[model samples]
Target: MDFDDTPDEAAWRAEVRSFLEQHRGEHADARAWQATLYDAGYVGVAWPVPAGGRGGTPMQQAIVDQEMARLGLPALINLIGIGMCGPTVIVHGSDDQKQRYLKRLLRAEDLWCQLFSEPEAGSDLAGLRTRAVRDADGGWRVSGQKVWTTLAHLADYGILLTRTDPDVPKHRGLTMFVVDMMAPGVTVRPLRQMNGAAHFNEVFFDDVLIPDAERLGEVGEGWRVALTTLMSERLSLGGGGTAIGPKPETVARHVAEHIGALPADRQVLARQQLGRGYVAALGARYTGYRQLSKLSRGELPGPEASAGKLSGTRSARDLADLAVRVLGDDARVAASRDGDSTWQNAQAGLPGIAIAGGSDQVLRNIIGERVLGLPAEPRADKDVPFKESVA
Candidate 1:
C-alpha cells in the first residue's frame, strides 16, 4: 500500500492544520476545547458528508487524527457517539434516523454512550439480560441495568442492546435501540475508578420507553446490528495508541529534560524506559496508518486490529508504570506532572480495556479463531438461551 498521501489529501491535511491553528491553538482544557474542533469541521473527517463529515477516506481520517494529536488538542469526548454510534446509524438506521442523529453527534451537539454490557454479561455479551418488552402503543419498555457505560452521565442518547426473546438462542433474540438519556425511567450513576475519576457508570433502565422508530434494526437482528457497531467500536478503540499522536515523544523529551534537572546519581534505568516508550509510541502512530490503509481499501483487519489495541494498551500500562517511577514523588499530584502523566487517567483505566471492549483473553480468542484459523474453544452454552446460560 502507498504510504505517501495524494496531493489532494495533503492539501486537506494542510487545511485542517490551518483551521485548528487558527481557532483552537493547543490551549489548556483540551476536553472542553474539542467543541471548537467539531465546529471547525476537522472532527469526524472520514464520516459521510451526509452525516456532517468531510466524507474523506480512511487514510485522510488517519491524517486528521495524527494532526489532532500533533496539536495536543483535547481528545474528543464524544468517542462512543461519533466513532461507534454515528457509524452504526449511518449503516443501519433509517434515513430519518440518520438525519436525526448523525450530524448532531458529529458536531458534539449530543453526547452518547454504549448500553451493551449488562450486570450479567460482558465478554459473553450475547447473554445480556436487559429486557425490552413491546408496549400497547408499539413502543418498548426497557428494564435492566448496564454496567461500565463510559460517559453515561454526559450522554444525551445511548445505543442500547436488550434481550427481546429469551426462548431463542443467545445471539438470535436481541434488539438494539437509541434511548434518550433523560427519559423518565433512565438513571445514570457514576462508578469511580482507581484514578479518582468517574468516567464510566452503571445505567439503569426502569421501564424506559423508546419509540419503535428508534430501534436500529428488525427485532432479533440486534446482534447483527450490534456487530456492526461493535466492529466499528473495536476498530476505533484500536486505531491509535493510548499516547495518541505526538504525546509520547513529548513525554520522552520531558522525562529526559527532568532527568537532567535531577542530580546525576538520580538518573537511572527510568530514563531508558522513557526512551523505549517514545519509540513504541512512534511505532503505534505508524501502525495506525497501516490499519487505515487497509481500511481505505475496504479491508477489515479483524484480529490484526487487536494487535494495535494490545500494543496501545500495553504501552499505556507501561508508560503509566514508568511515569510513577520516573516522576518519583511528583506522581502524587492530582493533576499531571508536566504532561508526562496526562495519561495517568488512561493508565489507571487500561485494565478496563483489557476487560471491557473484548477482554485481552477474548481478543486472543478472536486471534486464535480468525487469524490463526485454529480450532474453536469448546462451549456447551453456545446455543443456549440467554436466561439459561450460567453466569
Candidate 2:
C-alpha cells in the first residue's frame, strides 16, 4: 500500500496542523484541550456521527494522533474513555447509553478506567472471580476487587467485567457493566510504581449497586463485548506506541552527548546497541502501520494488534534499558538532582508495558494461533464450569 497520503488526507492533515498551531496554547489543561478538540470534531474522528463523533476515516484519526504527538501537545486526559470504552460502547451499547456517554466522554466530562484485571485473573481474564448478582429491584450488586486498574483513582466511570453466573463455563458466565466510580461501597487505593507514579490503582467493590440499564451486553455475552474493548486496547497500546515512545534518533543524540564520560570500552558497545535499537524501532513502526492499514479498511483490529503490542512494548523496554545503560551510575540519582528524569522514569515504568493490555507470552500465543494458523494449546478448563475450575 502507498504510505503517502491521498490529496484529501493531505488536506485533512494540513487542517489539523493549522488548528494545533493556532490553538495549542489556548487550553489551560488537558481536559480543556480535549473539549476544544471535541468542538473541532477531532476527538473521535472515526466514530459514528450519531455517537457525537465526526464520522471520519480511521486514517484521519491517525493523522490527528500523529500531529498531536509531533507537536508535543498534552494528550487527551480521558484516553481510556475515548480510546477503549467509547469505541466498545459504540459497538455494543444501547442507543440511550451512547447518547448519555459518548458526547461527555469526548469532551472529557467523565474519565474512564478499565476494571477488568484482578490479582489472579489478569492474564487469564476469563477466570475472573468478581461476582455480580441480580438484585430484587432488577439491578445488580457487585462485590469484587480489581488490580492494576489505570486511572481508577481519577476516573468517574469504569467498564467492569464480572462473573454473573458461576454454574456456566468461565467464559460463558461473565457480564459487563458501566460502573460509577464514586458510588457507595467503591474504594480505590493507588499502587505506586517504581517510577514514583501512582497511575495504577487497586479498586474494591462491596455490594455496589448497578442499574440494569448500565449493563453493556446481554448476560453471558460479556466475553464478546470484552473482545471489542480488548482489540481497541491493543491497538492503542501497540499501534500508538509507535508514535509515543522515544525515537532512535533521540537515543543516539543522548549517547553522543554522554558517551565520552563513560569507559572507552563501553562506548563502542553503546554505539552498537543504539544501532540495534534503531532497527528494532523501525520493525515495530512498520508492524504498527499494518494495523493502521487494516483499520483504514473498516476492519476490526485482528491478531496483528497483538503482534504490534508485543513488539512495541519490548522495543520500548529495550530502548529504556539502553538509555539507562548510557547514563550509567547517574541513572540512580533523583530527577530533582539531575533536572531531568525522562530516561529514568522510562526505564522504571516501561517494564510494566509488556504486562499491561496483555503479557508478551499471551500476545505471542495469539499471533501464533491466529496469524500462523498454528495448533491450539490444550486447556483443561475450556469446558469446565467456573465453580468447578481449579482455583
lDDT of 1 by residue, 1-391 (tens): 4576668777987987887778665446544455567676667878888877877676666667767777766667787888788888988899999888887787677899989987778888988889999999999999999999999999999999998998888999999999999999998999999777898899998998899999998999999999998788778877642343226756676576556545565576776777777677667656766776676666766454676776666665666666555656666663454454464665676677666567778888887888889999897787887667754
lDDT of 1: 0.77
lDDT of model 2 at residue 302?
Answer: 67
Off by over 4 Å in 1: 25-40, 240-246, 260-268, 275-279, 295-302, 333-346
- For candidate 2, what is the total of clashing residue pairs? 0
Checking candidate 2 for backbone clashes, the offending pairs are none
Per-candidate TM-scores read: 0.88, 0.96
Stretches of candidate 2 off by over 4 Å are 296-302, 334-338
On lDDT, the candidate that comes out on top is 2
Residues 1-391 of candidate 2 have per-residue lDDT tens digits of: 3467778888999999999999989767878889999999899998899999998988889889989888878778998888899998998899999999999999999899999999889889999989999999999999999999989999999999999999988999999999999999999999999988999999999999999899999999999999999888877787733443677667778888888888988988888888887788777778777767766666765665677778777777777788888877776673555458898888888888888888888898888888899998888898988899955
Q: Model 2, residue 294: displacement in angstroms?
A: 3.9
Predictions in order: lDDT: 0.77, 0.86
